[model samples]
Target: MKDVSGLLERTAQSQGAQPRCPLTGTLMTRGLTVPMDWRRPVTSRERQIWWNADHSFGQIHPRPALDEIPEFYDFPTYYTHDDPNSLDSAEEERRIGALGRLLGSIAYRFERGAEPTVEWWGSVIPRGARNGLEIGCGNGDRMKTFGAHVEATVGIEPDQRAAAVAREKGLEVHAGTAEDLPPAIRARKYDAIVFSHVLEHTMDPILALQNARDLLTDTGILSVEVPNNASTGSRWMGERWRWLDTPRHLNFFTPDSLRACAQSAGLTVRAVLFRGYVRQFMPDWILDEARITAAQQRRAVTQADIDRQVRHSARLLAATAMAAPEKKYDSVRLICTR
Candidate 1:
C-alpha cells in the first residue's frame, strides 16, 4: 500500500556487495557464514548470509556476479537439475536405494502429502485456461503432471543442460532466467505463471515478480512457493536445514515478508499457505541430509548403512506421527493476481 517506487530506485544497490531487502527497502545485516556445502562437498568457499532484522528476509552476502551464478548450478548431482527420463530402472533404484526400492510404495504413501506436488499449482490454475508458464521447470515433470489441467504449458530454466533435457521431451522450454525473458517468450502474455522455488535464486526477486506481472494477463494467476525461514525444520536444523540450500538460493522469505513482496510488486495478494513435511513427521528426511554432511566427517555411507537408517526411520513412525505441520511447515506458497 505504501509507495515502493523509491524502493525500486534504491535496488540498484544490489549491484554492490550488499543487497537491500526487496520488501522493506532496508539494507540487510550479517546473519551467519556457511562453511561447507552438504550437497556439494567439493565446494569450500565460505559465504556469509545477511538478513533484515524485523522481516524474515535474507540474502547471500558478498553477492555473486550474474555471470558466476550459472556455475553454481552446473553440477551433475543436483536432483532438480537431473533429467528424470534418463534415469533407467537400475539408476532409479540406485538413487532411491535398496530399502526405498523394497518399501517404495508404503514409504511413498506414508510420507507424500494427500496432494501431489503439481496439485499446489494445478488446484489454483483458472479453469478453461489455454496456456501457462513455469519458471525453473526442471525436467518438465511439474509441467507434464499438471499440463492436463491447462491446454498447454511452457517453461524457462537458467541451466542450459537442464533446459535442453526438458526440450528433448517435446516441451517448449527456453533456457534463461526470469530476470531476462527471451524475445520468443516476451512476445505473449500468459494465462497463468507458476514460480515455484525459482524466486529465491534470482538476483532480484521483486523485479522478477514485476516482470511476471507484465507477462501475465489481467486475469492470470501467479502461484509461488519458497522455503519458509520460520518453519520448525528450519529452526531444528539451523544451518543444516535441507531447505537452506545456500549458494543456490540467493534469498530467503518468511510468511509476512512473502506477502509484502507480492503486494510490493504492484499485485494483489490472494492467499498465503504454509505447507511441507518436517523432521517430526519424516525422520528419515533428516538422516538423508545428515548423510551428505556426515560423509565429510568420515567414510561414505554404504547401502548397508542406508538400510539401517531406513529401519530406524520405520521405528520412529509411531512416536513421531502426531499431527500435520501447520505454521512449522517447510514452504510458503503465495497466490497472487495482477
Candidate 2:
C-alpha cells in the first residue's frame, strides 16, 4: 500500500486555501463542459448488439474527444438533469451495460493472467455498525458483504435487472435512485451510508449528500469513493483516460473538491485517502487507442492482438511498480461524519 498519510498531507499543503461555491458554499473545482445528449437513450438491445459485434473490446460508444469540456463554476457539477435529454432508466441501462461489458472483458483478461488486486473501499465500513444503506448499490455485492456484519442492510439500485440479482442473493434492495428513495426507507436512519463510485454520476452531488445525510443517524459516517481527476494516470492518458467515462462520470473531483462538496452537505470530513494504483488501466487505455487505430486502417482486431496487448500491459505494470512503488493513486476514498 502507498503512504496514505504522506499523500494526504502533501495534498492538503498543495491545495492551499480551498475555494468554495458562492451560492451553496460547496467546495468548487474545475468542471468539464462535455455536452451529452442525456436525452439519447441507449437501450439494452442496442448495448447487446454492440457487445455482440465485439465493440466492447474497443470504444463501444462515441465520446467527446477533448481534454476539458469547458469549465463552469457552480453548485451542481452537471446542469442537464431536468433537460429533456437528461438520463432516464432506459438510457441508464445502456450506460451500465457498456460499463459492464468493459469490466467483464477486463475480468476475462485477469482470470487468464496474474489478476490485479484492489483494496476495496468497502473495508471502510465500521465493524460495530448495526444497520447501513448503500446508495446506487448496483447488484448489492457490497450490501451482501455489509449484511454479514450489520444486522440489516438495505440497498438502493437503479438497475432493475441488477436489483433482481441482489434480491435473489437475499439482500433487502429497493429499485430506484437515492433522490426517489422510498418514504419508508427515508424515515429510517442508518449507522453508515455508502456511496461507492456513485456520486460522480449525479448532477447535484451536494443534494445527493444532503439526502444521504437525512437518512443517517446524527453520528453516522458517509464513506465515498470516486475517481481522482488529478491523478498521474489522468494526466498521462489525457483524453484516452479510461476513467474519463464522459456523460456517465459528470463530476471529476480532487480530494479538496470532494471534501468541499461533503462539507457543503452538512458533513464533516474525517479522512481523505487516495487509494489503489491503476496499472490495469494503462493497458486498457492502450487497447482502446489501438482499436481506434486499427479501425482507421480497416484491420480486424483478433484475440492474438488482444493477448499481445495484455502481455505488454502486464509488463508495463511490473515496470511501474518496480521503478515507482510510491506513485500517486487514481482514486480517492473519503470518510465523512454527519
Per lDDT, the best of the predicted structures is: 1
Tens-digit lDDT string for candidate 2 (1-338): 11123423432342334333322434444323222222122211111000111111111122222222222211132322112323454543343344323443443343222111222433555657778899987666777655555678898876555576678878788865655566657868888788878887654566678788877777677888787666655554444355655555545666666777788788888877655454343333445444433433346555455455455444445444433212345667788887
Candidate 2 residue pairs in clash (backbone atoms < 3 Å): 33-69, 33-70, 38-85, 39-85
lDDT of each: 0.69, 0.53
lDDT of 1 by residue, 1-338 (tens): 12234433444466566666666777888786666666566764666788897877788866676677777877776776663443355654565465555443443444433233566556777878888899888877778876877888889988888777788889999876777777777777878888878888877777778878888888888888888887655664566567877788888888877777788888799877765643333434534555644554545756565556556445444332343433345787888999
**Model 1 CA deviation exceeding 4 Å by range:** 1-19, 83-122, 278-284, 295-326
Model 1: lowest-lDDT 10 consecutive positions: 1-10
Name the top TM-score candidate: 1
RMSD of 2: 13.7
TM-score of 1: 0.78
